[model samples]
Target: MSEKTVIDLSRLRKPDYNGSVQELYFLEEHPEWMVCKTMPGGSVFDVGTIFSIPNSDICRTALRHKIYSLLETPEEWENIYGHICRKYARDKEFLAFLSEGPLEDFRLRGADTHHLGMIDRDTGEVYRKSFPPHPSQYVLVKKYKIIKPSRVSYNDNHLWDYSEYYGADKFVVPLENIVRIGLTSGSSIYRNYLNMNDAERKNYLKELGLREELVPWTLFAKPVVDFTTKYEPEDRSLKLQEALHVSGSSGKKLLDIIKMCILGAILVSEFFRKIGLFLWDLKWEIARDGDKLVFVDTIDTDSIRVTTKANYNNKDYFVNFNKQSMRDYYKIMHSQWFEATKSAKAAALKSGKSFLEHLRAGQAEGYYPGTPQVDRRFIDIQEDKFNTLIAYIYGQATLDSTIEKYNEIGLKEIGYYDANGVLEEYDKLNGMGEETVVRSQ
Candidate 1:
């Protein structure tokens, strides 16, 4: 394993008041912070990562609440959010979080979002997710997507034509597949568990030593690509089977399959994600129900990467911010890193080091492409301030108020501290004083 390196966050400063203890704890303990399939050991950081923003739900929500104006078209959104990103990026606490390398994990997470995180199954069948930098094996899951048939709406079809067709989710699965809660996708698993047969489910939960309604995220069964007899075309079917086989493989076998998929991944990037957030199109299930992986498709994560010109790449390749100026900053760093790596890889030939080995030795974990050194007007802020700003943005962007309401309902339904802790933490992390606004802005 590469030695973990943290970011050089001298820009952001601390705040007067202490940030929320619980919120800080969650950031520290989030499973992505740990090594895969192991506890007590920490995972190395990846700085090439950027936040995912595929859909317009956050924009719509902000618009509805007057956080965005009607004139705030997609182009306008870029300007507003770009400003927000640049401002927050310099916050001290946010810097600290980024230093820990939480941003690079390929799981879909956020408070107000529709989807949940990935499931880590005991059977060792983790969900197959693809990244722009690298892609893994993928299951078709939704058969209808590949071959469109009747029973689909016209309006949705128009929109669907532009969306990434292959998808998955863990919102609902069979009773037997339900295992422990996942780090990110626990919300979806628990919600699916609610729909299971209650009487048998209770007995099963007792046997598992979990309260009938306890939230055991981290260990879970997520929804994956499963193809059934509903589709035609023998070649396509064979191709999908190949995809699944590759997705289930390990070591070099996995890398081989990923290279093949990369052929179509660029197109997947073009149509599906405006910000290259392929994670939006994926929701792999770990439910080992002894059934064949079906070839059914379901359009989820509100796929539509609408953006104005040069919004996604002119600035930052990882995140478009749907804006220009912000993108430039991102682009400089990302392109520099990629170029540096390309040079590094060539140089490593003399050292007999592979590219992966090169990255581990040089610029992989704890490496943000071009930052701190690149920015001219760098600030030396306090750490507490960074915490306040991050907590505020995370809570608000994830729909803090809505989550609190849902938390209240879950408490009434299940009556557990864990039931409400997610939202409770959100509450504690958000709503800083006016100083937060002045400092960040």
Candidate 2:
């Protein structure tokens, strides 16, 4: 919402015989003068000048007089030009002329490249008109069916628009809701863990049940040890010095090991609930925006790896073994999860039963619990179904089996910390390490 200035209408007059009534009226309504002229081959130039001038009395008087003359004079198209020019003079910066004539002429000439007409759902024909921008960009439009509406694709239709048109409520869930929980913490856990000082490194190893001497014997142990010693004092220069001491190969090896542990922590925290039916191995990107480490990428199925319950078990309970496969699998799994939830809801409503009851029935009938219902809205079921879904996806579920299952699927690391000294790590067992190198290069 920026301020706009009006152009004087009288300055637009050229040595034409008369003026146009329609043009005069347009200037009166839209004091912001726009240039509209025909081109050589029936083309039109409809351009708006980007200039502003103070709305003054002289310009107002000229506008009124020019408009009056255009109306009074019969076939007086010349008067319209006078009014338009006067309007244009009010705004000095209104310089550039966008040609509407070309667009209009292009349409009139039956240009095959012009697919500008909008289809009217009611008439099933093209509707030629101007469309304005909406306050919200998320609005979508869709058609209703006689019996059941067909599934809509996000790419093909606007979810918000369709929801509004169909009387379905649309809510703007903030992008923050999809953010990883650990990212809310200020420190980059992966980077901090990787850059741990000797004491911190020993502490970490102790957590993993490794003795002091045993730590150095592990693969990539030197870098981990160095990281511990470097970051222990929070001394920036010292940490860099220590990091520089390690060879690139050692850094890569240590980074891989750290990433695995961090991925384990994330998987343990977020994607545990969907463990049994679907594997969740997702690419995670984090950045230090201000003092916080924020996840900045799509956590959808496309960025993650997912597998069917059968396939996962058949493959010995593995998820994304590589970054590409991991992301691809997650995309499919996420889509499937969404579809399953929709189907389950539809089934429950159709049967006039609660989702949990329907799920219980399905379980009895030997159907896999595709998105289990944790609670009933009608009654205060202990487990909130929606909350359960959120918890499961974010790896906040209480079930140990769920946690173990996702871990078995192999979480791969994919991103690093930002410039604010936030530590980053990625899962390396699944070739995520290789994918990261390829993408970075």
Candidate 3:
């Protein structure tokens, strides 16, 4: 662990976008002086931020930029931005007409326009045909801007607010297995795959194999792939809508961003495949910079799910080298608590109360169980696995052992290479080969 910076409580203020795990703080003088505070020993069912890893944010941010660098295309960026400009123009036109037209007449026309899905919010439902930096890199604060102001320590141990200085808020857009080499077909393919019945899926796979001249059933059974946007539930979405001015077009834009995320996923998967790991599925945190979308936050094991070829088909959902493994353990082992939590949450929402308050009430009445204590062995194993994964991701691990493990698992027949080149590949794949130009100050 690194040395702690003594913070003065008077200088900091909380932001509206604080999450369950991470709290956002801004300097009273400079609101842009963003600090992300991750709670220590704060586990949701004993699986969360490992405080031992002090520079976790820096590493995760670097990793996100690496994945996004794969999508960078200087020539095409202008064309892409033009489309957003056009969409914004259309939105402005609608707003002007709404302001000028008679209230009764505009209301009648608005219903018809909405029914046909002509324009979504003020942004419109527009998508780019090619993959460009959908969410280009948006740097909130530079490394130099991050300060460890100290010497004035105040005792606030009751709430451990040790944090990394940076930005906040998030929106996740996930691309599943269905996104292949070309995302020309778009999210329709994802929707089709997700909605397929058992018989339909079998027939579709058979037809796909026949069309592509492939024979192996194993190919089709590899993993389910599709692109989807994760949105907060109604209450949460309403809060975001009110707070951030988020509209329907924001969600639509995220769906468009999925294509870029798909490309990044392919690049990342290829890199992971080199080291005896398979990128199962990962979610991306994106935000808007003016009219252009950009990748934000970190893409680490927490945002992704990983598994071996051997264990991918497991019904137990035993994810290898990912936080999902911890979540799966709790879901299976602590069913009573899990069920109680769901009930309490539902009851809380029903009565317009917070989940914690409802849970405490239930516990006092002896109707709900307390939070389960995770096994010590599980915690130890999770910590070790996370550390090992971090080492591998950072390219600090001895590739020889990972290569041997890869061969032992019979992945060599799939592809084999010299271990020495893995480091070289890591630097290139991670966008560390050249000096990174900071996009924002």
TM-score list, all predictions: 0.22, 0.18, 0.48
Q: Order the candidate numbers by TM-score, best to worst.
A: 3, 1, 2
lDDT of 3 by residue, 8-62 (tens): 4334455534554445555454443344443223234322332232333333433
- Clash totals in order: 49, 67, 7
Give the per-residue lDDT digits (tens) of candidate 2, residues 90-161.
444321121122222222332111111222222323222221111100101111111111233354331111
Q: Lowest-scoring 10 consecutive residues by lDDT in candidate 3?
A: 111-120
Error of 2 at 96 (Å): 64
Worst 10 residues of 2 by lDDT: 38-47
Candidate with maximal lDDT = 3
- Model 1, CA-based lDDT: 0.25
Per-residue C-alpha lDDT of model 1 across residues 121-164, encoded as one tens digit per residue? 22212222211111111111211112232232353231112112
Most accurate candidate by TM-score: 3
> What is candidate 2's CA lDDT for residue 286?
29
